[model samples]
Target: MSQRYHVVDRPDSRAPLDPRKLAQVLAQDGQLLLPMLDLIEHAEAAVDDLIDVMGRATIEAVLLMSAAGVAGPKQQGKRADRDVVYHGSQAGRVALKERQLRVTKPRLRKRAPQSGEPGEVEVPAYEAMRKDGRLADRMLEILIAGVSTRRYEHVLPEMAETVGVSKSEVSREAIEAGERLLKGLAERDLSGPDILAVWIDGIQLGPYHVICAVGVDADSHKHVLGLREGATENSAVATALLEDLVRRGLDPERRRLFIIDGAKALRAAIDRVFGADQPVQRCRNHKLRNVTGHLPKDQHEQAKATLRAAFKLDAKEGMAKLEQYASWLEHQWPDAAGSLREGLEEMFTINRLGLPSLLRRCLGTTNLIDNGHSAARDRMRRVRNWQSGSMALRWTAAAFDAASKGFRRIIGYEHIWMLKAALEEPAKDRSLVQQAVAG
Candidate 1:
C-alpha cells in the first residue's frame, strides 16, 4: 500500500537519515536503562573461576610439555620447563585474559638425531585467553562502586567529543558484570562468624530502606553480617533478616551481643532467637535522650545531670538518684516518665553487676552501632532514585561491610565476666545482671 510514514523531517532528521543508526542508538540507550549493576558478582566468580580455569589450563599446558617428551619425545622423561609457574609470565596472562582462551607456544630444545645439531621443538600454543577478562580487575573496582554506589550507567567512559565512555558499553559490560556479581553475595553461603556482637541499623537511600547487621567476632573484627529492607526497623523485619542469616549459616545465639538501636522489634527478635538470656545493652546515648524525655524541658538539663550522676554513682547513690529522677518525672508527666524510666531501670539493674565501665559502655545506647549506620548513610546519600529494597540492600551490604572493617574492641577482658555471667543466667534477674555488670 502506498504509505505515509509518521516521521519527523527536520534539518537534523533528514538529508539522508538512517534508521539503523537511530535504532542502534535507541537500542543502546535502552540497554543503558536496564537496571544493570556492576560486575561485582561475576568478578568474585571470575576471580575464583579464572583462578581455576587458568590454574587448570596451566596444568594442562605443563602436561602437554611432559607428553611432548613422555608420549612423543625423548626429553619427555626430563622435567617440563614450564612447570606451571605462577610468576614471570605477564605476556601469557595478558593474552589469556584478553582472549578468554590463550594459545601459548612452548619452545623445546633437543639434539637432532639426524645431524647431532641442536634443533628447537615446536609445541602447539596452549590457549589461555579469557575474552571477558580484560579490564575486569580495573572494571571490577568500578563495577563494585556501580553496584554499591548505584552509579550504573556512569561506570563506562570514552563516549564523546567532550569525553566519557559510551553509556551502552558501560551498561553492557560493567554493570552487567557487577549486577551478576552482586547477586552472588546473596546466594553464597557465609561462614559463621564468632559474632561477639551484631550491630543493626536501617539506611535510607533515595526511596529504599535497608537494614544492616554488622557482626563482630570474639576478637572484635567485624563483618558486614547481613541486610534486609522494610517499612521500618521492626522486630519482625529484624527477625526475618536474622532468619536469613540463619539460613546462610550465621549463629545469632552464639553471638555475644546484638548491638542495635533500642527498637522493640529488634529486642523482641533477639529475645525470641537468643532469649532474654543474652545481655541486651541499650545504646547509652539513646538512654540519655529517652530518660530525659520524661521531664519538662526546663528540667531536662538538670535531670540529665542527675541521671548521669546515677549512672556513675555508687550502688546506693545510683538507686536514690534514679528514684529522684523517676519521682520528679512522675510528678511532671507520669506516663512519659513511666515509659522512659523503665529503660533507665534496666540500665541500673545492669550496672549493679559490678561491671561498671563495661555496663556504661555496652548496655547503654551503642554509638558503635549508630556510628556504623551514620557512615553508611553518608556514603549512600548521593545515590538518587534507588530502585528497590533489595537494590538498597546491595549498597548497604557493601557499605556496612566496608564500614565495619575498622571496628576495634574497646571493652576489656575483666569486663567480659559480667556480660558472660549475664549470658549464662537462667532467669531474668535484672538484679543479678546488675550485680555481675557492677562487679
Candidate 2:
C-alpha cells in the first residue's frame, strides 16, 4: 500500500476554541449564520427529514431556554451566590400545539427565606405547558373535522414516543373542550350586539331534539344565540329558549322580525315571550314543502310556482292569489290548501314593509338559520351516537362553534338597514298614535 497523507498530522494555525470568542461571534452574526447552518443541514436531507429536524430542533431550543430560566447560568465550580439550585432533570411531557412532546425538564430548588430548607420550585414554562387547553381545542377541531377518536393519531404528525393520543385520551380532551365551548355559547351575553332579527328552528339529533335560535345583527352578522334540549319542538322548549334569550339580554321589548319554520309552537312562544306584536315571518320554503307533501307529485311544480309567484306580489295581491290557490285545492288537497292559508299574511311581512327584493329574499324565511343548522349537521354527521341531552347539546355547540368560523355576511346585507327600519315602523306608528291621543 502507498503511504497515506493525513491532514490532521499537519500543524494548524487556527487558534484553540474559545467560549468567549464563540459567544461574541454568535452574538454578532447569529442571524447570518442561521441560513448557512440551515443550508448545510438540509442540503442533502429529504423534505420530510428537513421538517422533522427543524421541528425537533425548535422544540429542543425551547426546552433548553426553559431549563436555563429555571437553573440560571451553569457554573464551572461551586457558587453559593445563586438562590436557585439545579436539583436534577427528569423526563417530562408537555403539550406543544396539538402534539405532546417528551422533554428533559430541569428540576430546581429554592431555600426558604424563613426555614433555610430547600423546597422544590416548579418551572413556570413547564406548568403552562402541562395545561393542555390548546391540545383539547385541537382535539375538538379534529373531531369536528370528521376524524374519529380511534383514528385521531393517524392524522397527526408522526413522532417518537408520542403520548396522550390514545382514543380514550382524545375522547376525554374532546369532552372537556366541548363542555367549555358549550358553556361559552350558553353564557354568551347577547345584550351587546345590535341584533335586528331572530330566527328560531329545531334540529333532531338521534332521539333528541333541540330548538336553536340564531340572531342577525344590524350589520348582517349572524350569532348562534341559544338552544334548548327537548323531546320535541313544543311550546315549552321554544318558550324556554326564547325566555333564556331575553334573560341573556335579547331585549324582549325591542321590536325584531321573528322568522320561523311555521311551527305554531314557536310562533306561540314568540308571542308569549316578546308579545304578539313582534313581526313574524313564516318560512316560505317550509310552507311549500308542507303543501307539496299533501299534493300529488304531478301538482308539485304548479303549486310551488304559484305560491312563489304569490310571494312576489303586494301584500293585498299576494294574500288574494294565495286565497284563490287555497280555494282551488280545497276539494282534493284540503291539507295543502290549509297549509297555504295558515300564516298566509306573515309570509308577506317583508313585502308589506316594502323592503327591496334583496332584503325580501334574505329575511323572507328561516333560510339564514337553516343554513347554519345545515353546517352544524355537516360537522356532526360523523357522530353516530347521542348519549344524553347534555352530550347532544355539547356536540351541537362544538359543531356550531366550528361552523361559525366560516360564516359570511348575509346576502343583500347592504339593505339590512331597511329591515331594521321596517321592524321599528310599527313601534314608531304606535308611539305616534299614543302622542296624538294624548294631544
Candidate 3:
C-alpha cells in the first residue's frame, strides 16, 4: 500500500504579521493546522495536556503584556528617572473560570513622589484574574444543580494547582451566595411590576414551614414576591410575608386577586393586610383534595367531578351546586361536607369576576406558585439536614432564584387583560356604592 500526504504551503516569513490579527484569527478558528509529520508525532499526546500547555502560554502572554504596562520592557537599560521598577516574579493563584490556576505573577514597585518610600504596584491582569467573586456564583449554581458539597471538587475541571474546592470552602461559598440571594429576594421592589394577582403557599422543609408569595403581573409574568419562616402556615406567618411584600413595594390598595390554598390563616392574612374587599380565590385543587380526602376512595371521582363542574358555572349557580353537594355529603360524611363548604364562596371568585375561561383557569388555583415550589424542592433535594430556620430560608431563596430564571409567561397569557379588567371591576363597584351611600 502506498501512503500519500497532502502538502500545504507555509506563509512567507518575511511578511509583517499583526499579532492581534493573528490572535483574532486563531480565536475565531479555535484550531491550527499542523504539518502532517508534526501532527503524527503529537498524535499520542493527551488533549488534557494540550489544554494545560495552551492555558499556561495564554497566561504568560497576558502577564507579559500587563508587566510591560507597569515596569516597561525587560531588557531596557536601567534609568534613574524611572518611576516604577520590576520587583521580580512571585508564585500566585488566580481564579480561572470555576477553579483557580497557579501562575508566576510579575511584580512591580512604584517610588513615592515626595518621600522615597517604595509602594507595591498591582498588576492589572493579575488583579483582574484574582477576583473570585464569580467563583462563589459558580459554586452556588453547581450546588443548586444538585451537586453535593462533598462532590463539588470532583465536578470541577481538573487543574494543576487549584484551591477553594474543599468541602468546607465550598459550603462557605454556597452559604455566602445563598445569603446574598436571600437578601436580594427579600428586598426586591415589587411596586414596579403591575401585578394582577398574587399566590400564597407554604412548604415544609424539615421542621420549618416557609410561606412564599408569588405575584403574576399584567403581562402574565410571575415574580417571586417574598417568603417568611414560621412554625406553620399560621396567620402571623402569612401576615408577615404579606406585610414584607407591601413594605417592599407591593401596593396594598392594588385591586389584585389573591390566590391561596385552602388555609383559613392565609385568607385571614390577605383580608388583614390587603383588605377584606380584595378578591380572594381558594385553590380549587386544594379544595378538591381536601373534600375528597374525607370520603371513601370509591366516592373520590364522583365528588371531584361535581366540584370541578360546579367551578365552571356562574358564581350563584356554582355556589348552589356546591351547597347541594355539601348537603348530600352531610348525611354520610359531614367532614367531607364541611370541607366542601369551607371557603365555598372564594372558590367561585374567579367565576364571579366574569373573567374569560383562559384567565379563569390561570387564576383559579395556586399552581403558579406551586410550580415554583416544585422547582425549589428539586434544587434542594440534596440537602439532607435543615440546620435552622435561617438556613432553610437561605436555601429556599437560592433555589427559587435559580428556578425563576427558567420561568416563562403563564399559560393563557393572552387573556391576562381580562383578568386585569375583572380585578378592577369590584374596586370600581365599591367606589360607586360608597358614592351612592354618601349621597
**Clash totals, every prediction:** 62, 0, 0
Residue-wise C-alpha lDDT for candidate 3, range 341-402, written one tens digit per residue: 98898898887767777778878998888887888888889888999999889888888888
lDDT of 2: 0.76
The TM-score obtained by model 2 is: 0.80
CA lDDT of every candidate: 0.53, 0.76, 0.76
- lDDT per residue for candidate 2 within 1-439, as digits (tens), equals 8998765553655755543344333434345434433442333322223226444334334334444556675565766466677776677776755567665656777744447654887765556556535778888888888788877777887765566577888889889998899888889999999899888877889988877788889999999898789732488888888999999999998988888888888888889999988888889898999999999999999998998998988888888989998999999989989888888878888786668988889888888877877877887887888888888888878877877788888889999998888677766685674355335
Model 3 lDDT, residue 205, Cα: 91
Candidate achieving the largest TM-score: 3
- Give the range where candidate 3 is weakest over 10 consecutive residues by summed lDDT: 33-42
Off by over 4 Å in 1: 1-164, 167-192, 231-233, 251-255, 291-300, 313-320, 333-336, 348-353, 356-359, 411-418, 425-439
The TM-scores, one per candidate, come to 0.57, 0.80, 0.81
Candidates 1 and 3: which is better by lDDT?
3
- Runs off by more than 4 Å, candidate 3: 1-54, 76-88, 109-121, 159-164, 426-439
Sorted on lDDT, best first, the list reads 3, 2, 1
Say which candidate scores most in lDDT: 3
* Candidate 1 lDDT over residue span 48-94, tens digit each: 24334333333233423433432243342465444322111222222
